[model samples]
Target: MRPSDRVTLEDVARAAGVSRATASRVVRGDTGVTAKKTKAVQAAVASLGYIPNSAARALVSRRTGTVAVVIPEPDQMIFSDPFLTQTVQEISRDLDEADIQLVMVFGDQSGHGRRAAKYLRNGSVDGAIVISHHRFSGQVEAIMSVQIPVVFIGRPVAQASPNSWVDLDNVSAGRLAAERLLECGARRPAIITGSLDMVAAHDRLRGFREVLGRVGIDPVLLEGAFTAESGRAAGEALAPRIESGEIDGVFASSDLMALAALEAWRDRGLRVPDDVRLVSCDNGPEAAAANPPLTSVDNPTDILGRAATDMLRAILDETWDGQPVLVPARLLVRQSC
Candidate 1:
């Protein structure tokens, strides 16, 4: 090739010893190429500095070159919840690297989900990544009818056969948090759960229950909406039990909830770890900086966001495995417990 001439896919194919069609497929992010051929094509593309034409790729793939991220909550919730905010930011960053636009859509109960669903079905985007897919919601029902490739950020309750997803291992996190609280001398423990509608809340409660069952004791269940406000309310409601010594330990489903509850308990003149031991999940930055560092489980929302975006790409490429991906969870020890 001349020095001034742009490197072509043809040159890449020849250098990689693969057919022109194979080279094109690899350049466009298709995973159907054999492992050996893929590696060869990658090496050739890098060495030759071959830039895949985005326009040409769109023509070949018959795609709009954009993807939608459907969130099943109102705008306020997404902005207020750090976990959701971080997840969206990570997904946007990952998609931006590939020249893909991330469209945010709300699918809450406010009748906006129907409009979002209509927009999704209109073929405006190449595919979709849904977050917090609540069951029986209008948005879910409408979006489920779309024929394009779709993936979920978390394990959906209504994931039909072949629905792609990525989620944190909440059950193990719950178990770890429960064990830590018990080890710290928590006898009459309670578990503050997230929204029961989401599968995460159930999984956490299940894991916590497993640990409590070992001692033949039942856990006190407090339902929250994975929000600090909900956590505060749950904490304030526990004034009676906390003061009466009915509940001495607590495992809140999310760090946001745990932190808010801690404040409320303190307002009620209760001391953390001294009055009642506490544990939480999602070892986000806030957890470490709390008045007393939180003993929590590490459920990195950024990791979940990136994995979910990757899953959507695989689906669009028609090379996705049918298996769901579960990011592992572990415990982070600190002063609270």
Candidate 2:
């Protein structure tokens, strides 16, 4: 074919010795095509330099071959948290494997949520994966109001969730942290938790409290923003209690917070596991970098990301049966405990 001439699907079908429908099905990634015919179609596409015009294909398929990754958090929070970065990267890679484009949107802050909701409602993408949405943010309400297929990366914070979601077993993770603290002989334990607006945070705190109560330990609770600074503040608040022998163990809901607590203890000349044992969630690099290496719970953010992407794909494919995916978490013991 001349450089000025466009190679159409029918041209490729003729070159591959297959019908146009068979070629179209292969290009659309539909299954049930024989391996020999599929190979021929691919070879013909390569030789003919055939390109599927996405705009034309969308007209017939009603799919844009694009999806939105909506992060309902401030830009600073997204950049500061490694879990968020890891999850986004995984989701992007998974979507890439499916030959789909990712359109990222920061939904929190100012009128971002409203604009994103409007864009999605306009059928700009086939579906969306919303992450870290809060109940009061009005973002979840906006997304749910749209007609697009949606999947959440965390437990939906809205009162009435209409879509499937993928989340870690946060309650179980909290219990695991609690058990690790107790096993290390931490009698008076305190918990530093993430924001309560998030269902994940609430579930983690609830699980931690339940397990501590079973052992007759009334844990001290501290609200944290899942930031290093918040962890430092919580640590400073507990310093006096640590000296008074009122608090001997700590469970920071996030690895960053746990590391901050470690630094705070170090500043007070307290030895880890000797004076206070600590455990946290999210087995991130910060956990491994602690002076004594903090023992932490594995949050499995990567798995959650892939699961969310898969769920969204299923929804768009019309094969979803309205079931949510719940990934599990585990504990990683280290010297801090």
Candidate 3:
């Protein structure tokens, strides 16, 4: 084809000596094709410089070949968190590998999530992969109202019937943290929790408390907003107790919060692992950057992202059987513990 001339699937089919249907199937990356025909179509495509028309393909296939990765947080919060960035990047890569496009949507508290839900409902994309949707976000309701498939990166706080989710087993993570603290002989342990509105926070706390309860120990629980400020406040609140030999270990729900806790302890002249051992979740970059490298739970967030995308793809392809998938979490020990 000459410059400014578009190469069509018909031209590719003719060049490969195959029917247009076969050429289209190859272009769509469908299965059940003979190796011989596949090679011929690919070779013809390379020789003819054929670039598939996305609009025309969508019209013929009734699929937009795109998916959305929705984060129900403000743009700043979404971008600032390293975990979210990683999740988006991994999801994009996985979708791209499947010959699909990724559309990122930052769903702010100010109705941005609902707007995104509307866009999804309008057939703008095939499916969506939503992350960190809280009970109060109202995005869940909007998502449930839409016909398109949605796969959540983390378990949504509220249940919308017949939804698919891919998440690390938060309950297992909590249980493991509790076991580690116990094994380390940490008495009078406490927890600085993430936002209670999030299901993850609830699951982790439940598992932590359940394990502690079995040992006849009740942990001191403090509410936190999953922010450094909240972590600092909780740390300050517990500092007095820690100093008096009352609380000796802590599990903060996030690495950022754990780092802030370290700061509060330092201000009070308390040293980590020496004075009070610590473990946290979401083993992000901050875990290693702390003065003493923090022990944290690796939630396999990238795997969660990949699983969510794959689930959405299956649903879009009418192959998913409506089962939820849970990836595992593990503890990475460091000086903080």
- How far is 2's C-alpha from truth in model 1 (Å)? 15
In TM-score terms, candidate 3 sits at 0.93
The runs of at least 3 residues in candidate 2 whose Cα sits more than 4 Å from the true structure, single-residue gaps closed, are 109-112
Q: How well does model 1 score by local distance difference test?
A: 0.85
* Model 3 misplaced regions, further than 4 Å: 1-5, 108-113, 157-159
TM, every model: 0.84, 0.94, 0.93
Best by the lDDT measure: 2
The digit string of per-residue lDDT tens for model 2 on 1-337 reads 6789989999989999999999999988899999999999999999888899888989998998999999878788889888888888899999999999999888854663787788888878899998887767676778888888889988886668765998888999999989998899889999999988888889999999999898788899999988889999999899889888999999999988888877888899888888888898999887887788889889887789888888898888888888888778789999989
**lDDT of the structure predicted as candidate 3:** 0.85
TM value for model 1: 0.84
Q: Candidate 1's error at 203, in angstroms?
A: 1.1
Model 1 per-residue lDDT tens digits across residues 1-337: 7879999999999999999999988887666899999999999999999988877767766888899989878677889887888888899999998789988887756673577778888878988888876655444556767888777876776444345778888888788988998899888998889998787888889888998799887988889989999999999988679899998999999999999999999889998888888899988899999989998898887788888888888777766786788989889999999
lDDT of each: 0.85, 0.87, 0.85
If both were scored by lDDT, which would come out higher, candidate 2 or candidate 3? 2
Better structure of 1 and 3 per lDDT: 3
CA shift of 289, model 3, Å? 3.3
- Worst lDDT run of 10 residues, candidate 3, spans 154-163
